[model samples]
Target chain A: MSVSHPPGVHEPGILVLEVPGDLAAIEGVVDHVVEHCAPARLDRRRLLFNFRVGLTEAISNAILYGNAGDPDRRVLLELRAVPGEVRVRVSDQGGGFDPESVPDPRLPENLTLPDGRGVFLMRELMDEVRFNRAGNTVTLILREPGPAGAKIPEAVISTLEDFRTQLGLTLVAWTLAGERRVRVFPGGKVGGADAPEDPRPGSDAHGIAGTRRFRVPVGAGLAVEVEVAGHAAESPVARVLAAAVERSASLAREANRNRAALEAALEANRHIRLDMARERLSREMELAHDLQMKLLPPIPRLARVDAAARVVPAKSVGGDFYQVIQLSGGRVGVMIGDVSGHGFPAALIMALVMSAAAIYAEQGAAPAKVLEYVDRAIGDELESTEMYLSLCYCMLSPGFPDIAYANAGHPHAFVIGAGGEHRRLPATDPPMGIGAAPYGQSRIRWKPGEDLLLLFTDGLSDTLARTRRMSGEQQVLKTVEENRQRPSGEILGRLFELCDRATPSIPSDDRTAIVLRTR
Target chain B: MSFNMRRFGEVTLIEVAGQLIVGNRQELKRMILAEVEAGTRRFVVDFALTGYIDSSGLGILVSLSKKIREVGGRLRLASLNEDLRTLFELTKLDTLFEICSSREEALAE
Candidate 1:
């Protein structure tokens, strides 16, 4: 290994290494070369990435295929690094292969092959890659990205130009550095010209009888001397010209200041508008969240039933809801549903669905009839919005051996036996929007005071499933089964505890679960 | 690389941790192939912990998918971060395998 710089240069811009033709030597050589290029000041991310992956692939290719793994063969690695750019070359002693014949690894047919990816990776990571005629040598290059600046607004420049033209001054000249003369006059044209010697104020110059000079100090060690020639010192026209010249200087300065203030105000206005939009969106979300929470009928007081239900809305309000209604014939109607998407749209649909379901269920309608009426009310709105919801409604009457229920593609409804066994009440129809009228209903054998009715949305299960090895639904069922002997409220609490403990990998959804035990 | 394998009903979930580069990609291939030989027909490769993968690592996945398909098995990828998802899409391999948002959905399918 040898590291050297040009004879007189202080920085090491060149490096050379002799690598043995072995796979084990690749990492060491690549690392050394990468370390050498650190002073080039390339972007840290690209520097670490492009060089590490590109050089590794290049050197490994040189040893394995170029040298054919011969013990005596040697590979040469060279690095030339300068500020904002880097170049690397790797050469082997063996005869070369055809670079054009390498098959693309991304092709579907070749995707399963594992050995043809080195060259492809090098090409992808490096900005440029080239091969020598013999194919035994390859060069890689990377350059620092140039700055991307925003374009200047043309309005400011044009406005200043227009203001200059309005001044209507003639023979206005500025002597910069006491040598270069910039002439601006008559038709708003400006150009450089050789200037005569300085003229004293109030002196006649250029053979004019009453040539008056006024010197205006611009910042930055420069001044503009406005000469009003061919006019008397005290004439009205001469006085007007002098005042215009004086005002032009101060006006120009004030214009610059005003432009800056204008830009700042524009920027601040943009931010204020953005803040107002954000505030409005959050307010609307809060309103929807409040409405959804308030609409949930408190678990209706029942004489022979222990009913408990909870709905945990996500950060963005989701359409998860549960309604427990008291019926006239001493029956309780339990409804749990999950609208497909989130935000105000889902909230609106949820509100409509809850109102419709409540009206029908409170009238002592059967489970199937209640779902039919709710779906009919929201069918057009769901179709227009292209959204759907899964819903399940169950009617439990005391002293009945079976519970009559209607399920619309809601998969979490289950009957848990006192002994910890459970059975699914399968969907009687597709989801509300997609399924047709005359919703089918089903009956499950209910053991009063012994069995527990468990209903939940996908949010509860999805959240629990994120960290657990088992499906989220299974975990919920297991939790319920273990706590079946406890009060329904306690069982619901345990289920929520499991949900709160699991760390969800994805954005959480609204969770709603209902556990009711009828005696 | 670290892998956590758990069975959710019939679907086998494998959680890949850390970078799956050239050095550690073979271990994942061997693990999945062995499971396939053991008659595990459904699989979900969860990438919630994985941060990076090189081309060679992708090659092993492709080959493993091919091998799994020969035995009438299915492979699904879940929880890929934005960069990893872009890699699969760029390689056009996202179309070859089932890509799901969450492991729950993947296992259910």
Candidate 2:
């Protein structure tokens, strides 16, 4: 079905065409319209047609015939005028396929495939084929010629409309005058001398050409002798032609103004969207940081034990942890861990290790037993995951005077005491989560005036030059020896400060230290 | 951080000359793994020039060291920077394998 044009009026109007079920018929009708209407409005074009309804058929046919016309399938099409281009969209309602997976149809075997050519042809015809929502929605864009055909300003369009209406009324009066004179002087056609022949057709009651012809009365007289013989009035269809030319000028001005306004609006919208995205990202980052911070334990005050511990995180959220917890039976459970990596994953692993330690420590088991339990608890989870944590757990008691600790793939702990010597503790077992290795607690002895017991992470020692020389041990001992006279907190601070001085801005993991001064 | 590579036959000695941080780990891993795959398994990493080793970078080294050991080859480390040497000593990783005083000693071992 199609809407036809009204009679005798020289104004453009939209035509709507609808086709049902038949894909072939749809293409035929669209092709015919393009051929006929394109030329008619090719010059001095003032026609706009909207096809809101038939988009389904047009798109489906493109998918079916163009894409082998598979009958069970459906597609969608949309055509709209954007700022600089005319956009046509054709989206297939098929199981969405990756755009990258579609091989070039120009290849021999691919040429025969029914599904591929549709997209290729559409791509050739359209300026761009943008896929939205993982290839579910596709848009085809086409640009019009000459700056979207010049916008006529609203003020100019209104003025031109009023002038044309007045001119049309005057022309109607002239037509009536010519008809009356012809009827009254019917016999005088033979007697009166013939005036200069009016070359215009009889329908042209007022000879206004295709250009706007300004006619002004030169002298005051009963019959105004206005000169209309110049440039504008010389055309055959002068009156209507004059109105069209004036309308075109106004249109050009209006289109420019509209384009300018539309561009400004688009720019404003882009800025607003960008600002909103930045704000959302900032909020998400803050939340992640807060969650990481909450996962850490509060600094434990070991007043009875005379222990001073300090942890300095490299980033806003780091993976290092050092805690001294009061266990059952008047024993103290001391833990120091370095989760495998940094940032969010490391933070999460640290949290997990802390929770697991808390639960296992409640059992009042031996240090080796606690580690074995922790290994099993995080077994498959840590093995399959990319990030993991390394931990050290020690249970110190008054009866033992020394401590029994288990190391699961972490840097060894230290004892700085009366002997004025610093010694590295042994790892009794392999790192946690690497298929369980046996963990046995080793005993340590301390005498009176045993100044300090230091447990730390690797961040303090692993500098590039030191890592290469394998001299981190020597450096750490030297730093400890130099700062032995300082307070426990100052000693820990000096250790990190020494690390920083050695490496400058380079970070060596997360700095964690727990020092106990024997009173 | 700057990375320096010295190829001695198939044994590639990588001397990392700067601070080792989290951001450069991926690039470091890519280079090291690519070398490993190219049949240069006998490696002597000279961290003497490196100023620091973060947890992320250390993890990469540990994983790489295990990978090399699995393939019937060894990753010998020598001349650790001041801070890193302390980490190795504190971690007791200094005792787990052969740690030499210089690149020549590491290669000789």
Candidate 3:
């Protein structure tokens, strides 16, 4: 449908554009308004173009950043058309910002930062502005016809003059369309309002990082407030502009929230579709995880051997894994892997690596050959998919006392004897994903009753403390040496405990570890 | 060392809190300067309350101390927190000023 403007509109044309508070809808509104106005009004010298850009900005900002993409907010837009002017008012349903306290985005260093430019841009675009007390409603005025002149209302002028005695120096400027210029003139400071404090030279007031007020004269005898307060300009002006801005924001938010509630209510029946999608994904992940987990043998029910394993995926699904398999030939195969990063993709890659390792192991492949196959398969897949995984695999012979293993970017495995002698089985190759590194194996014969073998992902040793000084493999060895007297499971647990104690609050990568000991 | 305060008359303690970060630091500096110009320099700053501080806060604090000292008075800080006190010790301001356990102790010193 075409936009309809009523008759009797004067020199400046005013059109109101309304859109939902959703980011997509607000953006559509911006495009629609810009498309309608930019071309047609090129010839019009004095036109009043107003619609709720500021309000839309506030509501959409709340939708995108504040609520973090929650679809429950409703926004309303009200457009008022006057002679040579258009005012767009947007109100949101969400809680509003405190106008006096927004962080300054225009500070010298903040000019290039990614945040805090929205309000400043909004203020620059509108000719005259008003903000509500709660900082929700914002009224933005645009003069399509360009500014007519300093038309500050006599009442406001007089009020300002009454308060001018309080300010030592008041500089006012007209912030016209497409400009950021403030000039010093012959006029003295107007007196009226109570002065908070006179900013001294070399003080924050004198710097380019604080607030300064100015006046803009729009067409048809309307003079709007302009602030050039250095860095503080955005917040206090946003406060004054909040009256108009907040209303628009409130209206927009209310509309969006109501829309969301309706959609959510409808979702009671509609959730079948979402559930269907979720179930499909869950099915794939469950199958993948099950298959991968099966490759890991359940605890060998041997009374003599002390063995345990743990894996915590960083997501609903994860790439970091630990597995122990009871081979058909009466041997045990143990492996640990870390996919390049945490996510479903990584989990998927890890699953592939696990399957390849299992297939190789089932064929009676040696520790080195199994790793070579897994690495080749994983490296090929990573190359094809542009992703990578780190893997470590081991084969334990009942006849041979030492554990045999190969590391592909995985940390070294630790071995602790019953009497506290500790040693690390070091791998001789780079990570599997590097493509060119050939997997190599190392074997150590176990001493009679060498009771504990620890296999772990890097998560245990890769902590903030070890991040700079040494590699996780080195830390693992150090920790193992320190805790050699502990049981295999206890050693792994204590290693993680030590790292956790060092950097308690740091968000760590996923952690996984497996312990196997000859009885 | 990071934050210092002194009493001019009685009961007017000027305490500085947090890092007076760059760009916005002039405000804090001016506040102190204004009070100094107004001749109300008597201050008992509890630095123990400050968790962190930066160069600007340090510059302002030192400048205020110098300003007050030139005016025949001083600024004293009480109950310095561990980190700030460590910073003071590192900066060697621990020797330039009196160290006290509490605001009352600083006042007495």
Winning candidate number (TM-score)? 1
Stronger candidate by lDDT (1 vs 2): 1
Model 2 C-alpha lDDT per residue in residues A20-61, reported as the tens digit of each score: 222423333333334334322322111121121123223543
| Candidate 1 residue-wise lDDT, A316-426, digit = tens | 667899988888879889999998756566788999999999999999999999989998999998875556899999998878899899999998999999899999999
**Model 2 spans with C-alpha error above 4 angstroms:** A1-283, A435-438, A463-473, A500-508, B1-109
> For candidate 1, what is the TM-score?
0.44
Candidate 1 deviation (Cα RMSD): 25.9
Measured with C-alpha atoms, the lDDT of residue A394 in candidate 2 is 77
Ranking of all candidate structures by their lDDT, best first? 1, 2, 3
Assess chain B of each prediction and give its TM-score: 0.95, 0.89, 0.73
Stretches of candidate 3 above 4 Å error? A1-297, A302-305, A328-330, A417-421, A462-508, B1-109
Ranking by DockQ: 1, 3, 2
Question: lDDT of each prediction vs. the true structure?
Answer: 0.72, 0.53, 0.53
User: Among these predicted structures, which one has the highest DockQ?
Assistant: 1
Per-candidate TM-score against the hidden true structure: 0.44, 0.40, 0.38
- Two-chain complex of model 2, DockQ on C-alpha atoms against the true structure: 0.01
Colliding residue pairs in candidate 1? none
lDDT by residue (tens digit), candidate 3, B37-100: 7876465556655544433344456666667778866677677766556545544556656667
| Candidate 3 residue lDDT tens string, A1-519 | 012232344223344322332342343344344444443333232221123334344545545544455433333344554444555655544566765564554454443333454455345435555555445555566654322222233333333333334443243433223221212121333221222222332112322244344333333333334342341444554344424323443454466557666754554453354345334444554565554455445666654556678764332344677777677546777788887643345556877777788888877788788877776776665664444566777777676766778876665466766665667677657776564545677887676465577777666656534555777666666676677666767876877776667667533455677777765
Q: Return the number of clashes found in candidate 3.
A: 91
